[model samples]
Target: MSEFTVSGRYKNRDGYRAFETTIDAVNEDVAREHVLSQLGSRHGVKRTEIELEEVGE
Candidate 1:
């Protein structure tokens, strides 16, 4: 697994919220998906409301 830093923002009841998180995954694609899944499950965010700004390893 590789370490990735994912930074993005999502829409919520209030407004747009920024987020930055670390993830361990095989590649950038998986890392991105992991971020989306995490945000969705934890914060009730939808994929359509997410805007990923940067992803780096």
Candidate 2:
């Protein structure tokens, strides 16, 4: 696994909220999935509410 910095925006009750999170994954796809899963469960966000800005190691 590698360390990745993923930045994105998500919709909340108020509006859109920006987020930057670090994750360990094999690739960018996995990192994205991880972020989506976390945000969905933790923040009650839908997949369409999240927009990925950047993914970097």
Candidate 3:
């Protein structure tokens, strides 16, 4: 299964919390794009304001 997820809170340093479920994928690029698209369009967040980081991980 392919899992794409996000975790973040507004205005909390990184301004969000996000992560993905465990899954295997042939190509990871498209999954990332999908996650980003969902976050921006569905959540009303701009792409520029979102930055992936290694905090909780």
Stretches > 4 Å off in candidate 3: 1-26, 54-57
The all-Cα superposition gives candidate 1 an RMSD in Å to the true structure of 0.6
Write the residue-wise lDDT of candidate 3 on 1-57 in tens digits: 455443433223555665443333434565555556766776677777666442221
What TM-score do all the candidates reach, one by one? Answer: 0.95, 0.95, 0.50
- Measured with C-alpha atoms, the lDDT of residue 38 in candidate 3 is 63
Candidate 2 ranges beyond 4 A from true positions: none
Better of 2 and 3 by lDDT: 2
Model 2 CA lDDT for position 17 = 96
Query: For model 1, how does the per-residue alpha-carbon lDDT over 1-57 read when each residue is reduced to its tens digit?
Result: 999999989999899999999999999999999999999999997899999999999
Per-prediction tally of clashes: 0, 0, 9
Task: Point out the worst 10-residue segment of candidate 1 by lDDT.
Answer: 37-46
Position 43, candidate 2: lDDT: 94
What's the CA error at residue 4 for candidate 3, in Å? 5.4
